[model samples]
Target: MHIQLVRHATLRVGYNGHILLVDPMLSQAGEMPATVNTPNQRPNPGVELPMSVEEVLDGVNAILITHTHMDHLDEAAVRQLPKHVPLFCQPPDREKLKNHGFEQVIVVEDDYEWEGIHFDRTGGRHGTGEIGEKMGPVSGFVLKARDGNEPTLYLTGDTIWCEEVEHALKSHQPDVVVPFAGAAQFLVGDPITMTKEDIVQLAQAAGNSQIFVAHMEVWNHCLLSRSELVEYVRANDLSDRIQIPQNGEKIEYQR
Candidate 1:
């Protein structure tokens, strides 16, 4: 399995000979407005795409959307993506994507199979208390190749160390785990995404799983930077187990 950190929470994954894009926020730097209720008022995407838009989209056959947040699936993505490519998402996002003129919007409520890949929809908590409630529902994905050559992959969509995430880690025990870290916060309340402490906890419980950290240093609201996370991991003696890939860098995994 091959995974590329496109930028922030966006990812380009190659599994079982299929190229899949996840949560594509394709806007250019400073094109979108700054996130509200956050400390930094700079543009939403603080950095530019490491590669050109066409380069990122090259050879992508399908898209897996965890949610419809603007950062995850923005207007730029809706406008730029091919109308016919299969778009897999949770049930709640089906109508939204269809309304955007996407020809194939498949909802994976529990588990579904397409070609040689198996996609299992999993639950997540965006945050806690009223902030989490207002943030609404989100979903994660567990993917496995039917032939079993590729290792099991768990994409923990925008969530902290909540019960649902713990449950997913325990149940899936994925060989490769991708946690959407950044510790993104608002003017008030706790972080909406996984923090460094949360990552440490997850790594401890992940057994022998290799963890790849994403969703950092792009958005204004995300407080965690890649450098800071690297320091924390090294201090915690987890540098070998946790990898923080730079934007557009590709990582290959084997079972």
Candidate 2:
């Protein structure tokens, strides 16, 4: 399996002869509006995508959206991505994608199979209390090759360390785990995304699974940086388990 960190929570995953673009926020740097109720109220996407827009879209046959938040599936993405490609999303996002003029929007209510790949939808808690409730429904996914030729992957959408995450980790026991870890926050609530401590706890719960993290240093609301996460990983003696990939960097895994 091959995974490339495009930018922020966006990813390109290659498995079973398919290139799946996950949660693309495709606008050029500063083109989008700033996130409200947060520090660093600057325009979003603090930096540009490591590659050009065409390069990012190249070879993408499918798109998987964990949620419809602007950071995950922005207007730019809706404009740029081909409308005909298979779009897999949660049930709540079905109408939104269709309304955006997408031709193929498939909702995953629980488990779905396409092109010999198994997708199991998992639950998540975006935040706590009122904030989490307002954030609405979010989901993660467990992907595995039906033939068992590729490593199992668990993509945890915007979420903190909660019961849902722990349950997903325990139930799937994926070989590759990708968590959104920017410690993103709003003005009033606790972090809506995983903090460094939350990442550590995830590492422990995931057993021997390799943890790859991004969604850092891109948006204004994100509080974690790559250097800080690296330092924390080193200090915790988790250098081998946690990986912080640079934008557009690709990592390959063998099953």
Candidate 3:
């Protein structure tokens, strides 16, 4: 299996003749507003799209939306994607996505099949305390193909490290794990996503799973930078298992 980190949380994952686009925020750089009030409050996507929308859209068989946040499911992505393409999302977001002109909105409550691959919605905690309640609901996915060659992949949605994340590690034991780790915060309250400390814990818990960290250096609210995270992983002796991919970079995995 291969997953391309197309800036922030957006990705193109291909396996077993199927290419699934996840959390597509296809807006051009500087088109969207800053996420929150902060020093890094320049624009939503600080960097431009590495490839054109046409390049990213090639070979896409379906769309898997983790949430309806502007950064995840923005206007550009909605208008660009084919209306008839299948959309897999959480139950809470089915209506909202349908209203956006998506023809097939499949809620990932149970296992949703695409061709031969199986997609199971995994639970996630977007934040903790009162902030979490206001952040709304979000869910991740555990995807595995029927063929033994494809390894199990867990894409943890916009979330902070919690029991649910650990449970997924212990239960599915995925070969490739993508966890959001920008420590994104607003003016007040704790970070809504995983911090360096949390990443350390997750690395320790994974045992041998490969981690490709996302949600960094994109939005104003995200406090972490690639350089900072790289140093943290190196200093903590977790660099061997973790990969901080560059924007538009791709990582291939085998079981």
Reference-based TM-score of each model? 0.99, 0.99, 0.97
Off by over 4 Å in 3: 37-39
Q: What is residue 131's positional error in candidate 2, in angstroms? A: 0.9
Per-residue alpha-carbon lDDT of model 3 for 1-255, expressed as tens digits?
A: 899999889999988778889999899889999966555678777888889999999989899999999989899998899888888999999999999999999998867877778888887788888888899998889898887679899999988889988998888888889998899887777888889888888889988989989888887789988899999999999888999999999999888
lDDT of each: 0.93, 0.94, 0.88
Candidate 2 clashing pairs, residues 3+ apart or interchain: none
Model 2: how far residue 32 lies from native, Å: 1.3
- lDDT assessment of candidate 3: 0.88
- Sort all candidates by lDDT, best to worst: 2, 1, 3
State in Å the error of residue 203, model 2: 0.6
Query: What's model 2's lDDT at 159?
Result: 92
Steric clashes per prediction: 0, 0, 0
lDDT-superior candidate, 1 or 3: 1
User: For residues 34-127, what per-residue lDDT tens digits would candidate 1 score against the true structure?
Assistant: 9898899998788999999998899999999999999999899989988899999999999999999999999998999998999998888898
